[model samples]
Target: MQLFIHQMNEEASNDILTWQYDRPYDFYNNERTDEALQEILDGSYYRMNDENNVLIGFFCIGANAKVPAGNEFGVYNEDLVDMGVGMNPTYVGKGNGFEFCMHVIRFIQEHYPNKAIRLTVATFNERAIHLYEKLGFVSEDKFQTLFAQFQTMIRREHQ
Candidate 1:
C-alpha cells in the first residue's frame, strides 16, 4: 500500500484525536486534550494516510517524545530518537502491520538518519514484538510500570 506521512494539521489531528480502538488495542488509542492538542500542533506528531486518502495511523519521533506506552520504560539518551506509532482502529488487524512499520522506519531513516530509533511496547504485545524482531530491532531492556511490563527495542543506524 502506498503511504504518505504528513505533518499533523488541525483537521488531521482533530480527526486523529477521535480514533478509538478495541480491547488490547484500546491501549494505543489516544485521548483528545489541550496538552495532546499542543503536541500535535507543535509538530511532534504526523499523520499517516494511504493512497486512497484514508488515514492509516500516526507516528511521533524526537528527543522530547513520549511514545504510546508513556515513560514507563524510563528516559532514553538524547542521541536516540524515541519513536512511537499507532494504527487507526479500523486498520488494526488486516495484515498491514509490517507495511505500516516499515514506512515509519523509512520515514525516520530519511528525516533523522543520524539517530538510532527506540520504542517501548507492552511485553504482552507479541504481534508488535514479532514485527519488530522481524524488522531487525533488538530487545535491549525491560521494565515494568503499575499497569504492564514493557520491552525496550532498538534498531541502530547500522542495522
Candidate 2:
C-alpha cells in the first residue's frame, strides 16, 4: 500500500470519525473529542492514506504539543517535527503498522533535517514500546501520572 497526505476536508471527515471510534483510548478521549479533531484538521494536520483510499493515520509537523511532564516546544529546535499517528483498529495486526510508521518517519526526517519525532505509549503497551524503540526512540525518563491512580510510565524521546 502507498501513502498520501491530505488535509481534513469534507471528504476525509468520515475517515477521521472512523479513527475516533476505533481508538477511544488515544483518539476519542476528552483530549481528542470531536472538537479537538476539528481543531487538528482545521490546523492542517497531514492525514495519511493509501492508494485504496484507506486511512492509515495522520501527523502534524512542528506540532507544539504538551507532553504532560515534557515540554516539546522548540525541543527538536531545527528540522524536527512532532508527529502522532493511528491506524484503524480493523486493519490492525495485519503487519502494516511497522512499515507504515517507518515510511512516515523517514519521509519527515528527510524533509525536516534534524527533526526528532516522539510519541507516548502507555506503560502497559509493550507492542508500541518495542515499535518506537525499533524505530530509534530512546527511553528518556519514567514519569508519574498526577492523577488519583498515581500510576507511572517511561517517557521515550527520539531525535
Candidate 3:
C-alpha cells in the first residue's frame, strides 16, 4: 500500500478524467477539461499514486466545499480540516478503500498535524460512512439539503 500524494499537475488531472466509477459514485467524477486542470493547479485537489507510480485516486483537503446544509449539519467548522476523496473506479469495491483513505489521512497529517478532520457524505453512501468510521470518524450531526440528506462526521484528536 505504498502511496504518494502530490499537488495535481495537468498531466495527472487529464489522466484522472479517464477514471470512472459505478452509479452514484460516478456522480462525483472529475471532468476532462481545462477548468478541471485549473482547479487542480489551484491547489484544492491532490493526485495520489502508488509505489509503482500508478495513479490510484485523488482527494481534496481544506477545499471548503459547500455542501447542502453544511451549517445545519454541523459539518463545516473552522477548527477542523474538511476532506473529500474518491478512488479510481478501477480500484473501488475491491477492498482498497481503507488503504486509500489511510493514505489521504497520512497526507493530511503530514501537512496539518494535530488538526481535526471533518467530512460530509450523502446519507445513502453507506460504504463511505462505514470506511470513515473504520478510520476513526464519528457522525456528529445529520441534516437535509435541497437535494439530499447529509451526515457530518469528524475525526478528532482524541480519536
TM-scores of all predicted structures:
0.88, 0.68, 0.87
Q: Which consecutive 10 residues in model 3 have the weakest lDDT in total?
A: 64-73
- Model 2, span 1-159: residue lDDT tens: 787777656455555555543342443333436776575667646667889887776655444232445442222333335566666665665777788788767767677665456554555556666777777776544444443111122222333
Better of 1 and 3 by TM-score: 1
Candidate 1 per-residue lDDT over residues 1-159, each given as its tens digit = 899999888888888889987788677667899987888778778888899988998888874354444454454534577788878878777889889999999988898877788887888888889989988899977776777878778998788
lDDT of 3 by residue, 35-151 (tens): 766766778888889999988888887754446458754556567888888788888889999988988888788888898888888888898999999999999778887767888
RMSD of each: 2.3, 4.9, 2.1
For model 2, the stretches where C-alpha displacement exceeds 4 angstroms are: 18-34, 64-69, 72-80, 146-159
Per-residue lDDT of 74 in model 1: 52
Alpha carbon lDDT at 23, candidate 1: 81
Lowest summed lDDT window (length 10), candidate 2 = 147-156
Arrange candidates, best lDDT first: 1, 3, 2
**lDDT for predicted candidate 2 compared with the true structure:** 0.56
Off by over 4 Å in 3: 64-74
Measured by TM-score, the strongest candidate is 1
